[model samples]
Structure formats: structure tokens, C-alpha cells
Target: MNRARHHRRARAFPLAMLLAACAVAPPVSARVQPADAPADATKASVASEIRAGVSGKLKDFYGPRGYWPLWVEKDAIGPQADALLALIASVDVDGLAPRDYDPRGLQRLIEEADASPTPKALARADLALSKAFAALVADMRRPARGIGMRYLDPEVEPRDPDPSGLLRAAAVTPSLTDYIQTAGWMSPFYMRLRTARADYRARWGDLPGITVPEGVKLRPGGNTPEIALLRHRLGLAQGAAYDRALAARVRAFQSDHGLAADGIAGGQTISALNRGPAYYDQQLALNMERARLLPGPWVRHVVVDAASARLWYYSKGALDGTMKVVAGARESQTPMMAGMIRYATLNPYWNIPPDLVQSRVAPKILKGASLKGMHYEALADWSANPAPLAQSEVDWGSVAAGRSEVRVRQLPGGDNAMGRVKFMFPNDLGIYLHDTPSRDLFAKPARHFSNGCVRLEDAQRLGRWFFGKQPVADGSAPEQHQPLPQPVPVYLTYLTAVPTAQGVQFLPDVYGRDGD
Candidate 1:
């Protein structure tokens, strides 16, 4: 071969080597990108999917939008999308927005998926929503007919709405259950729905308080906010077929939770009851913990679903007894833990927490001086009265009182504020389950009251069980406040999802604690 031909052959050989290397070399780039590079992927795709489905839903439910789904792109969907996306960011979900998230070269999260709570819940919610919609679509299939059909059932009986069960259904499913088991649904929207529903049922159902307020339109499944306020005020969401039984029970609950005993669903009564479902779930989780505590041959014991604002004393695997109780007010949430009541207190002292004294009690004493109603003792001097300023001495005749350093306390007795007796199951919170002189509060459909203690109904019966009452009334009550050899340990817990009393009852969450 000539010199020129040899040179050409060498050049061709080098080109062939370059091609081979390109084909076999391992990749060095660790960035995540689409086969088709960036182009408003997150916003465009997610919005397209959500809007297409959600728009149809809004149109179908509210009728041609009727000015409801109007401006959905710029107005409606935008806000919801932003909230959902912000939540996604909080969960550290992949592809969170660049404006707020950093594009760090971290390996993709694997089973660590188990550790992150928010993402797990969001994923569960998305899956459940998808599954439920699919089921509904299947339920209302075409049958080889035309387009979609079946509007919201107007003929459907307008009973109290119950969405907690809906949420429970989704959470209990094997796939979504993981989220339920760990974090649980606690968004403020859920609480709003829960409390709003309970409020209407308690207020609107009353006959005497029935002036039919505006915005009180009754829906098919649950009560509206206006409806709840009405029923709660009217004393209408009265009772079921067991009114007689419940009335006596209501009186008992009122006595237990510190409400007036008028057998009416007044503000106090409603406040003492209508807690949302989150509270009860806490109760369930705690009970599950208690179940864990008694790993031995534990047959019978009284269980207080404090978060559910109810109690069950069991013997021989049956509900031998039950009670209606009011739990901690929103500010002083009940603690979560386990304990056993070795005894019950006949009369109890209402120790005022420093926060309550400084915030609420002081303001009330300064303004209207209503200590007689709640049986409060204006502490003339908590710390030796550095300059004791009781409401009496501070001449309310002239003074902007929201600023005064007022302190108060209530002694224990029949009207001693804690009522006749208290069931003890001590926990770290310094909170307990007890009785109250004001018993009417339990009549309302919802309950959220007290600084952070639980008031019990038929305390004497609760007393009986702890005292070793024989035959432990399986369906009635264990026994009323009776003889006690030693003090019983009482635990005041905060739980909202409960499955007792009337079987899976939902409560109102007045304290606005869904954020927690």
C-alpha cells in the first residue's frame, strides 16, 4: 500500500474507535429529565388532568356551573392547585416547584417512603379518590346507553351527614390503611366538615328554638353550619328512639361534663359534645395502646374513649356499662396515654392552670364577674398578693379590664364546679375524668368544653366498677359512685374517632385543632 493509503486507513480506524466508545461508556449525568426535556410539565399536565375531571364534577353537581364553576382556570382551580402543590412541597415530593425547592443531586427516596407522613397521606388520598370515583362510575355505568346520568339524589333522605365513615372506609382499605395507621386524615377542611355537620344537627332539630334561620338549607347526608347552629340553639337534634333512655343519660352526662341539666341542646351542652372525628381516632389509637399494655390475662376493665367523649366499662367481653363525658376544652387538649383507675374521687378540686387563669378566667372576672355561675374563686393573691387585685377590690366601675392581672380558682363540691365526684386515672397532664354540676350541656349534639378535664355521667356507677362491683352490669352501668378502698388511676385522653355508645358516633371538634 502507498503512504497516502496507509494514512487514510489509520484515520478510519480512529473514527471507528470513537463510535464504539460512545456506545459502551457508562453515563455520568445524574439529573432527572423527561425523554422530552422540560416544557411546563408539572403545571400543564396536572392541571389538564385535574381540571378536565373537576370541571365536569362541578358542572354536574351544581348545574351548568350556574355561575359556580365560572372562571375556574384563573380563580377556582388555581387556589386549590396552589394549596395542593404547597402541600406536595411540604411532603418533599419529587418535582416540587423550582421557585421554592432546591434541585439537589440526592438519590431517589426508596422505602424511606414509610418515614415521610404527609406524602404518604397525599398519595393515599389520591389513590382513594381515584378508586372511589372509579367505583362510582362503575356503579352508574351507561348500560350501552348515551353519555353520563344520575344527579345528586334529591329523593335521598335528608338525614345527618356522616363523612367520617367515608374517610374511615378509605383509610381502612389495605392500600390506604398505611396512611391511616400512621398519620391519619387531619386537614382543617375535614374538621370544618365534621364540626359544621354536628353543629347543624344539634341546633336545627329543636322544636322550641325553631324560627328557621336563613342559610339553614338541609342537605341529604349531613347538617350545614347554619343548620347546626339552628338545631344546637333550638334543641331539635334532640335524640333518637332512645330519647327517654338518652334523656336520663343526658342528665347524667350534663352532671358529668359541667353543663346545666335542662335536658336541652343549649350552647353549653352543644359545646360539651360536638367534637370532630380526629378526637375519637386518638381515642381508638390510645385504646389500641391500652390493649397493648394488658398483654396478660386481662378479662374485664372500664375503658374511657376520652377523645370520643364517651366511656365503656366492660366485663366478660360485653359492654356492661357506658357513660357520656365532656373532655378538655380546645386550649387544654387531653393527653394521649394509658392508665387504670384503682379508685374514684367522691368530690374533686378544680385546679386552675396558669394559662387559663391568665387568659380566660381573669378576663371574665374583670368584665362581668360571673364567678358565681362557674363557682370560681378569684385568688386574692396567688403569690402572696404582691398587691392582691380581686374583682371586688379593683372597682370595675372604671378600668379597661382586658389588661388587669386577674386570677381565679374553683373549689370542689356538688356545685364546687367539679360537681359531686371525679373518676381518677392519672396521667402526666394533671387532667382527670370527673362530674360537673352543670349537666344540660350534654343534651346538644356536639360537645367541646372544660379547660382540659373529662366530666363523667352516672359517676356513682363508674365508682361501682372501680370498687369491684360484682356481676358488673354488662348492659346497664357497672355501679354508681360507691365505696373505694384506694384511689384509681384516671387518664384524660384526647381522641375523636370512637366506636362505642351508639356504635361509631362522630363528635364535633370545637377547639380548632385539626392543624395539630
Candidate 2:
């Protein structure tokens, strides 16, 4: 047999034995107490009920431990049980329905067990709490279609927690409270969403709505009657004329809502103002569902949020720095994806995509546009070692008409489309993070002006974060590949509602992917 087949059988052997042991183990009442020696009748009765109530994975977990209570001791609910119940009661903060976990029913069971201290009541409460925890774990890890988790493209599958493994770990933990709180069960990003949701509800859950009339464009130095309504809606002092202070507040509001921060009360800004706390709440809930698909916090990784046009670098599981990024335009929308960045390419060539060359470049060249300053070179074919050809040798008309094909590349230089360097993560989708020569676009508030790839604002800074120092070319080679000491995972996600220090900032769904 092959080595892989042998390895599979080797790993399956122990699992089979463990399952058999769990299936054949004697009941806790029989193992823990003999027929004549029922010194602790209450304990024996509770263990027997617990064994009869649970099945499947829960049975496997409890049977091996003599059916002992996980959440009760000495006929009283412990601190761990209290903590779990509280979290379940307020689980809406995590975009979860509290009723699904039945927090009220669990509480009633706990109260009855506390008052009468009967074996049946205690066993029921213990089983209920364990089942609630398991349900929570399953919900947090899996993306639910009912909660707006249906994506156009398949996302990176989240790692699901093992039920038996979690129970085993919780059984021996020193502090079950700490274990439930910080057990790496949910994604750290999801926790951030929870905090944002709670803060938003506390601050603006009941914010009164006051809509400004349409077609009212209030500039900074203009006097208008509509300015009064705008100021009131923004929570500023009532004013009749548009002034610098009101403009500044409007600009801040516009920035937070993903509008152009030009201090002008235009159509888009006024429309956003009309959408009060209800719209924001829906955004938070949708984003929380999206966060469910993200992996747990990593020691070293990069997160590129396309909706916000931003990038965050995490080192040792802490945010090291953030920078601006230019994502794909609406026409070529950037996709949500995740992969490991294995290396960096210095002085990289911008190999134009066939579609771009056929649609954009060939038409221009056909109209007598010079390729001298463009630094473009036409190649015979798209191979590792392709022969160079003059621009005039190719049939531009045929290429532009989609009747022919050709390979084109731009030499490394200041005017090259791909500026300086590019981080490579090989995938089926031809998308990677790279620098750009057009730095002016970064100044715009809504920066969505790329074909599909992500353009970094500070490529050198990101390079230094990846490799202790920036990788430099020797000035003699056209392209140089530098492998990283350790590969870092990069998650490209689209979060329309992002958490901020003050509260959640709702960004524009530029790609219209949010379905809001």
C-alpha cells in the first residue's frame, strides 16, 4: 500500500478504539455505586438521569466522566453556569437570536434546581446548559443563510470546533468562566462586531429621525433655510446659514457614512442622513454574519477590507499598523478571498491581462498612440521564455476585434503600472497586492479605481512589515523573487459596517454586494 493509505489507517485506529470504549462503557450508576452500597443515593440518581437524557457526542463526552455534572456541584449551579446563561441572554450583540438558545427556559431550570435541590432538577439544568453551549459553538462557527451569509463567491471555509474535544477541554479547565470567555471559540473579528453593535445600540438605538428636503445643496459659504434642518439632524446647534462649523460636522458625518467628504450637503449625503438607526442596525447585523466566515485571530497576518478601502497588519495578534488601499472598481469588483502570501517580487513586470489588452490597449495602439513612454513590449506568446516582438509586427485591428491574441508586458520603471513591488499569493483568481504609480487616487474618499487587484498606498512600509526590511533589486535584474522567512495569511473581506473607536461606521456598498 502507498504511504498515504497506510497513514490514514494509522490515524483511524485510535479513533475507532475510543468510539468503541464510549459505546460499551457501563452506566455511571452501575460503575460508581454498587447495588447494596447506595451511600450517596442523590448523586447516583442524578447521574442515571443525565445518562438517559443525553445522546450522540454529548453521551460520548459524559459517559467517560462517570456522568458527573459539568455546571453543578453540591446541588448548586456554579459560576460557570451563571456566566454562560448571561451570555446567552444577551447574544443579540453577536447577531444571534436569544430565543434560539432558550436562555429563559434554562434559567427556570436553574432556579428550580437551586430552590428544591432535587436530583432530577439538577440533572435537567446541567444537561440544558451543556446543550446551550454546544448550540452556541455551532452557530458562531457556521455561516447561516437565514442571517444574510449567502455570498456570491464561495468564501474560505471556517474551521469548525470539535464537540467532544471542547467538552473534554472544559471538563479539566481550572476556570470554566475563563474557558468560556477566551477559548478562541469565535473569530476575534466577530467579537469586534459585537462590541460595535452594543455600542451603536446604546448610543443611537432611539435616535429621532429628521429628514432634510431633497435638491437642497448647502455649501459652506451659502445662506439657506434648509441649513437649520441639516444642523438639527446632525445634532448640532440650530443655525440658519451654512457656516464652517456646520460644514466641518457635515464632513465628519459624511466621512463616517462612506460619502465624499466635501462638506457639501448633496443628494447622497442627504439620503444617508434620512437613513436613521434602523439602517445602521441592519448593516451591523449583516457584517457580523460576514465576520463569521473569517478565521480566528492569527499571530501574523494582513486584513484588506475592500468596502473601507483600508488594510490592517497584525503582528503577534495585535494591530501593528493601518494604511489606505485602492480596491477594484464597481465594474470589476474585488472578491472576498483568503490565502497565504509566500513571497514578494521586486521590480515586477505588469503583465497586462488579455482582456485589458484587447479592450483598452489594442484600440489605443490602433489609433496611432505611441508606446515609447508607456514602456510596453509585445511578445510572441505568453510563456516563461517568450520572444520579443515590435509593436508594429502585431495585427492591432484583429486583436482589438477579438479575432487574435498577443502577450504584452510593461518594463519595470517609474511609469510602470505596477509600481516597485508586489506581494504574491498564487491562486486561480489573478489577484495580488501591489504598488501603483497613481498615488493621487488614494486622496479620494471613495477609492475604487482598479480592474480587480488591490493597490497598496505604502508598498515599502508593508514590505518592511513582512520581511524585517524592504527587499531591493540589485539594479541589474529585471525581476527578483524574495521568499519570506514565514508565510503570512492574507484575508480580503468586504465589511460595509466596520467597528471604530466611537461606534460602527457604515461604509458604502460600492460593489452592491450587501443586498441592502
Candidate 3:
């Protein structure tokens, strides 16, 4: 993507666009009221009740406007009211409960006010609509339970939306429809999830429940009475004998559900098939909450979804490309975080983490293993320019016993753990994306084998995307720092429930972060 174009789009919509209007209009008193305006006594009564009824943000919002109704005009609900009510009704698409907003109650209030436009009735309806709008905006912005904070790293803090400012903007915007739809209130990624949720609900909301009996293992090229039931469960054609085609379908299902894709309808696979619509519905809701922690679509960034072991490059508010990735193993689970990739290190040395050195390398070295053949060396310190230390000078027994510690690093070569390059984000957690010599892991369906760092399937491809060309090393140097033209943001997130063409794919919670 063009740098200038990216910057232009990035600055096009500021966060305040949803909170505050671009140009403040004249005060409510400066504008003339409609011919059907209520009597002064009734208006005073309504304003007094509004002031008494609302507190906090709503009170502040309406106080400045003389308690005037934003959704009610000329004793009738305006188009803005209809639009807002419609949005509230469809809050389910955003993984929000419509009941929480009381859309039906709001609708009933509107109907009553329309039937008899009294001051008390109109005031009640107007206040209800404003409260509903505020609640919806709040939930969309920050979400309940801190936007899935339990599933995220402690470093990631979700930002809260300003309800008063949003309400003020909604009042002044020329077209409430456009403001609600295109004013950048919700993140584009969140909107995408909304669409996916709607699609999944439309397709699989009423999916039939089918349960193949437990303790029954059906493999391909086998004839059994349960084959027909299995086919029915998988949405395949009825067949008494499990054939190649059925097996292929079974494999696809197994892969999607995070099971071993051996094309066998084993107990686990059968259990997954029996996981009805309710499971997916809850999964989608959980993932939608998780999406709140992601960077907005306007920014140029790379997203690593730890759940699916995938990496996506997003530029110009759209996905540029994607590739397979290997995330942290269950034991050393990858944390959800956001950072900027400021530079890349070519011919990077795999600085073995201290913990790994204590657990793996120290034991081997104590067993008389040679570090030179492994391209490993001990560093005197972890400073920018630390001197190398001879292996003979180090006490391996104390290191393995956790009584002492030393810094160890692997030299840049074919046998190096870090293949050729490493993208540096520089966080306290010491997590970064790097090329790995172990490429076979990428081909696996479940690729969480790292120790809390992300391993790129094709570091050269990512380098080309990041630097417009693959960075190279002169072989004379190791840990060559190549600064990027501009820093690109990287967001590491987890989404156990991923949207797919057929329906939502519920990946296994490898780290058990999803509370499943």
C-alpha cells in the first residue's frame, strides 16, 4: 500500500468523530421550534422530570440542551428514533443481548407516545431512547467484563467510549443514519465480525442436532450401520459404507473442529459433530468480544491469531494477505499484545532465553555436549555489546540446579534456531516474530509448539511485505539491524471461534483461555 494513502486514510476519521461533531451547530435556543411544539407549562413539566429522571452522563447531555428531546420531534418519534430502535433490535449481531437494551419496551413507549402525545409520555419515550442509545454505544465501545480481559495479556487495556460525547454528536449530526453507520463508531473489524455472526446465525442457527453413539470408531472403506447416521450428522449423503468422499468430508470437519484429521469418525469426532448450534453461538459471542482488543482497520498492521495459528497482513483497511504461523505451546502460552515492528534483524542470532538455557541447554552441556558443533556460545552479559565467554569458565551444574544463570546464544547459520531474520517489536515479555529452521511445524493443522514467540512460516515473504523487499545479510555480521521505513503495528490476539465460509469454525482452546 502507498504510504501517503495509508496516512491519509488513517487520519481521515479521528476517534472524536463518533464522540463529537465535526462542526458544532447553533444552540437549541437559537433554533425555532416546530408549530406543534408543546405548551410552555407542559414543556416545563417534561424538562423538570427529565432533569430529575436522568443522572450522570445523560443528565449532563440533556442539561445543556434545555432537556429537549433529540429523538422526539413535534410530539412524534422522528426517523432518528426508528433508526436507533432498529440498531438496538439488531444488537444481537454485535453479540449484545437485545433484552439488555429493552428494545421492546422502548418500542412500546414509542407506540404509546404516538397514540397520545402528552408531555409525560413524550418525555418518558425520549429519555428511554437516549438511555438505550447510550447503553448500546457503551457496550460497543468497551463491552462487558472489560472486553474479554481474562483472555488477554495484562498489557492490553481496552479503551472506553465517551457516551456523553457520542450522544452530543448524534444530536448534531445532519443524518443520524449516516452517523450511526459510517461515522466510525465501531471498529471495522468488529463490524466484520458482526457480518460473520449474522451469516453464521442465518445458516446454522437452527442446525439439527445429531449424535453418533460413543465407543464407535468408523474409518474410511468400512461398512457399518452407523455410517448413514455419520453421513447425516456431517450433512453428507446417506451411505451405509464409509467411502473416500465421506472420509474427505469427515477430514474437513475434523480439521475445522481442531481434531486429528485422519478421516475417522472416532469418539472425539463424534462428540464434535454432536456439538450443536448452542456451542457455536457461544463461541461466536466469545470471539466477538475478543475482537474488541484488536487494532482498528484503518491502521496498517499484522494480526497474529494464536488460536488458529495464522498471520494476516492488513493494509488500507483490508486484508493484504495471510499465511500460516506457529504460535506458543500450551505450557508457554502466547500472550495477547500490541506493539510496533520498528526494525528487522538480518542473520539474527537466536538468543536462547534464560529459562530455556536452565531447563534444556544446561542439562545437555552438563552431559558433556559440545556447544561449538551446535553453534551455541555463552555470553558474558546481556548488554548491547557483551563479550563471549568460554564454556569451560561456566559452571553447568549450578545453572541446571537454578543456583546460577548465564546468557547463551546461537550463531547465525543453517542450524541456527532463528532461520535468517527476526522481526523486532521489543517488549518486556521478550516476544517477537522470527523465522524458524524447523519448517515442518507450519504444515501441521495445530501448530502451537513455540515457547511464547510467534514463528513465521515464510519470514522472507513477510520481509518482502514489510520492507518492500527481502532483507539480506552480508554473512560477515550477525544480528544486523535493518530499520524499517516506518514502524508497522502488530497485534497478537486469540480467537478460538473463527468465521468460515460454511459456518463458524470453533478451534480448540489450546491454552484453555476461552474458559471452555
lDDT of 3 at 455: 93
Query: Model 2, residue 70: displacement in angstroms?
Result: 8.2
- Model 1 spans with C-alpha error above 4 angstroms: 1-300, 316-318, 340-343, 355-376, 380-407, 468-483, 486-516
lDDT of all predictions, in order shown?
Answer: 0.40, 0.75, 0.74
Best by TM-score: 2
- How close is each model in CA RMSD to the real structure? 23.6, 11.0, 10.4
lDDT (tens digit, per residue) of candidate 1 on 354-409: 66666666566566666667766555555633353445665332223444444555
lDDT of 2 by residue, 1-516 (tens): 001110001111233333433444444434543543232344455666677787877887787877767776534566677778767767767767989988778878888777666556778988888888887877777775654322222334444666766676566656677667653455567778877777667765665688889887788888777888888887778778788888988887676665678999999888888888678778888888877766555347788888889998876435789999999999887788777788998888889988888998898898888555468888998787899988879999999999998998889888777898999887766789999999999999899998879999999999999999878887847778899888887878889887765445677789898785
Look at candidate 2 and give me any clashing residue pairs.
none
Who is ahead in lDDT, 1 or 3? 3
Task: Rank the candidate models, highest lDDT first.
Answer: 2, 3, 1
Model 1 C-alpha RMSD to native: 23.6
Top model by lDDT, which number? Answer: 2
